[model samples]
Target: MTDTSKKEQLYELIRANPFVSQQDLAVELRLSRSAVAGHIASLIRERRLLGRAYVLPDKRPVLCIGAANLDRKLRTLETLQMGTSNPAYAEEVHGGVARNIAENLARLGLPAALLTAVGDDPAGSALQSRAESAGIDTRGSLRLNDTYSGTYTAVLDERGEMVLALADMALYDKMTPEFLASRAPQRSSAAMVVADLNLPQDTVATLLQDARRDAVALVIVAVSQPKMARLPQDLHGLRLLVLNRGELETRVGRKLAGDAELAAGCREVQAQGAQDIIITCGGEGVYHTSYTLAGEAGLTWLPAPKVDVVDVTGAGDAFAAGVCWSIYQGNNDLTLACRRGLKVAAMTLESPDTVSPLLAADILEEISEFHPLHLPQD
Candidate 1:
């Protein structure tokens, strides 16, 4: 059959039943699974088909608030560096915790909006343009005139592990509570509000307060170890909290070396009122726990799938996107959500770019077909 004929058939099938899964579509259309997946991806990319399952019709777009900046990296050709210069390769791209998460969500076919501050320079303009191109609504973002856009530079060893990094993100200070207050209506209308610690402490506090007062689901991403403490002590209205092992240690005010210590830290944060907590332990895998009126859900850990390491720049952001996407899709199973998060993070780990272009919902479905994640029992 011709491509147009196949697309028309697929469109008719979807219009008839919006909840049809890709496997079902393949069977009904008498096409290969990958072919059906590709067609669905193209349809979504061309705006002929919407991702109905990935988002709810009644919910507003997810609001993401935090840093947006340019990222530069230098990878040494060989291991050995002190004060002297080393031969290396250099590259640059637009990156920030909130920006990466927002882009990943958009790529996964979710309605996302970004509220960040950037200078009026070329870098800021490029960042905004790229974000918009990637389907993120940047209307709520700020454009400062005098300051330069934020930038993060990292030096990596030959194995692609980060050796050292430096950041100039003072522009994030402009994303104050006053700035967020100006966009109060937008923040209140969101289905979920996601923020990273790149924002100032006062801004984080205001966001927490607004989310609580408005009764919106708040998801916070710990940008780094130092910034994790910026989160408010009273997480009364937090729906989900995403952080790494180091960040969790900082928040709990102690060293956590084993599963026992990690579980204690998770309980401590749950006591602070967060409904769910996801901690990404580099290679060991991810630990997740959910709390409800019934009681605490037991900790569920999923081992990370083995993959060739490329650059671990935005794996955490991709994981956050997966969890947020799953929640927005109305999935309450923490274990399932963690599996999805790991799947997405694995995809990101294989890509050198921060956000892989192949992060679409359909593409992920196809990848999972061949390389399914084995979830641990509760």
Candidate 2:
């Protein structure tokens, strides 16, 4: 078959079975596996297809657009209740939801960029230095003089679980539509674009809509506080929306606190316009459902393998990064992505840091001891 004919057949095959194997494509197109791979690469570049599944086939970078702030971590010998004020040991660390994602991506060997606004203040300088050290591209992020940098103050007990958090994200609120519009082309090249609700509603809305318009793979991290949970209800075109069980319940104004609740919540969110949904239930693992182009219409659930819970601070973000990267690679194989996500989340829990203890080079080794990607049903 001619190249055009092969491309057409491949599209039909994918549309019919979005999760079809590339080996299958090679056979059906009557082409060498390399040739099939090259064609798929071209199609991805043209935005004719999104990510495929497998081990990181494309090294395309991930983009994170959100807030970066300095974390003033307050440590106490015992838990400091949220409302009870007391003197505590405090230390400043680089933090923010978007910055955390970027650091994790860099550690995963996926080049990532952060497009956000930070103040030109000393705290902002510290954050910039830390992000640069992590090898994140910050060219697209802007610095403002008038607005002080965003900051978070967290009070933690000896166990390291947070007692309360106070966030000042007013700087990020200044990021405008025109700013993102100018950066849209760069954003469009992303293998995945991760966003958090720290941004103003208009800014977040613009990014999601632009991702849809440009056909970029999008990963929306619903970083829920009682405040962030009021996310705009009209997120129509996101490829994936990642949230914790409580956040999902709050967003939909319904109870979805278990695996079954998560599954139902995924469907509910999908109906609201997101193409795929995942609700992470702390110890129970992740509940994922996406519109599989192949199987029956609607969503399908994949359970992430369970592990002992430690720190839960960054687990959801780590899971989002893993699933987004896997899905971008054309692997709609939810079980595989979930396993990767769980592995990353576990690594984060085992460490003191918000990212993972394992670096990019250690991912394969870390996951190798776990159940293989294609787990067999007994």
Candidate 3:
């Protein structure tokens, strides 16, 4: 067989039998063991097909910059009667869109860093300690003195759904353009940069522009409510954008009444300059779109397996991190990439708080499961 044909056969063999050895390939392909090994190395670097037998992180690092806030949550199931304004219970946790993404990226075993501001108080200390223990770099995270760390209060019903939210992020408001600019050179090696709308518009724009100029991949997660519409308008070739189904429709100014509509809406957003757009339908799946050489193409919907519902607090951030990690690892199988995203989201929702219970290697393991078809055959 031709060399190309042999490589294709090798890739198929590895997918069918992930743990198969290079020696076995040598015997089967009539090639030297060293030749087979060299081919394997080339395939891996090309990210054609990957397996758990050999997966490595620390290969690419992710940088996250945005807001960090302490969250207080309350649990209550009092359905709002036609004329009632009362909640049953409330609870608290530490959460912010930026921090959530950071934690999720860390859990995915990718080198991750958080650049934000916090108070120089007990709450800030706790946040620092928690992030550090998770193997995240908190050195870039700032601490402001004589100021209270930002905090958010959220109410949940019996179904673990968000009822209302109130936040005080004055401290995070201090992460101005100057602060980010001063730290830019320190993170010139980042593989990707993740941001959200919690920070000021100028800050978001500045960071995106810098990342683009520096050639770092950029991903933005839309956080907060309808009042925060400035998010979609900031679109300018961001690597990816993850938003809820409703927000997707509203931002695109299209009525995505159903799955087909949602798919079309994602394409529309892609036309607006976002390199990739994903519309996450909670409990259903995610609708996505990406640009290709031919034109903007529709994405295959990746379904999330039904699981016991817990809290959906950090699911979106988890999903974003998953996709971001896969992109960094050079995996382009949208289907498997979505699965990796959903898996991390599920892990976070399985808990009451926004904290990620998973480790980095576990996330990498998920990324390794479904190799991209682009790889040569085993």
Candidate 4:
């Protein structure tokens, strides 16, 4: 074997058993003790293994990369007005697609790490504190000087439907390919990587390239219809791409009239190299397809459960987290994952918070028993 391949094998052995002795590693690889030591030294030089105990970098956490923002929601107490100020109730929270998904994953008992750009301002500090309080690891998150943290403001009608939303997410412009490359070790060791389209197009492409090279499970979440272009036309290494109907329409450049059209559009995107695709139809349900070992290709619809809507914000992020949790369990049955996604979406729909505070590791099990998600038989 090549020297590089041998070193990789030795490193993996050490990773599997950190306390394994060098003699064991030498015997396992049928190499001399000196050769094993050389490989270990090489691994240490590459930072794949740290310290003298063969301390490998952690590989359990799901890495989330993209935007982290301070979010504000204003709900109008009365009907619409055009040119004048309207009375409303306001609430502030820390929210961003990646940040929200990371929080959801953390609440679901996953080791979640967030790597997003933040400012040195109080809002940025508050955002990081809130994320840490939510059990997310923000040590790798970028903190910039003299920049305002990303912010999003949404105005909702009395029915909790969004009237208008404004986002000041220019800070995400700094999430460039170089920045992601600098965090190579963290990204490389993650169990999975989840990134949002809030990143620049070239940066997303760079991430996709890395996933393909390392055989990593990379999931990309769409942030907005306009941001759809940030995703490269070639999605070869993508494990999944979760997007809403509007976002899908934007990506494929056509209006998905109904189920048939949506399925066709998803298939088209999958043909472009995505292993799976989920297009969420708000209030309607989620349509998903997966490419498993058995090569399942048909898209199935999971109807959303009826819930008393309090606020619709962050429901999609919750759904992404639920699906991620199911995947992390090593189950390839994405159909079941869709059910979990819908359950979490339902939970979020019933709450006013960006991420439902009711979320817990066992919350899915608690809700799954009573509310079994199923499609209507034809």
What does each candidate score in C-alpha RMSD?
A: 11.2, 11.1, 12.7, 7.2
Better of 2 and 4 by TM-score: 4
lDDT of 3 by residue, 1-378 (tens): 777788787777765544467788889889999888877877778776432342223334587877777888776666644356666666656778777788877766677778878898898888888777876777777789998888888777777777677888877667878888667543554667888777777777776677567667788887755624656455574877878877786787767776557667766776676777777888777766643455546555567768777887777777888888778777665556777788877877787668667545665553555422221111
| Model 3, C-alpha of 1: deviation from truth (Å) | 55
Model 1 misplaced regions, further than 4 Å? 1-59, 290-298, 364-378
| Model 2 stretches astray by more than 4 angstroms | 1-59, 79-89, 225-230, 257-261, 290-311, 362-378
- lDDT value, candidate 2, whole model: 0.71
| Worst 10-residue lDDT window, candidate 4 | 369-378
Q: What's model 3's overall lDDT?
A: 0.71
Which is the winner by TM-score between candidate 1 and candidate 4?
4
lDDT tens digits, residues 62-147, model 4? Answer: 88999899889999999868799989999988899999999999998888989999999999999999999988878778899999
Best by TM-score: 4
Expressed as tens digits, the lDDT of each residue in 1-378 for candidate 1 is: 897799789878876555467889889989999998788788778766545432223436788999888999898999948899899989999999999999999999888889999998999999999999998878879999988999999998887888898999988988888898787655654788899999998998887787778787889999888888688898888889999888999999999877667877888898898888988887568888744345544466678899888888888889898888878877677777777878888888899999988888664443222223332222
Q: Among these predicted structures, which one has the highest lDDT?
A: 4
For each candidate, the alpha-carbon lDDT, in order, equals 0.82, 0.71, 0.71, 0.85
What global local distance difference test value does model 4 have? 0.85
Cα TM-score per model: 0.80, 0.74, 0.74, 0.82
The C-alpha local distance difference test score for the whole of candidate 1 amounts to 0.82
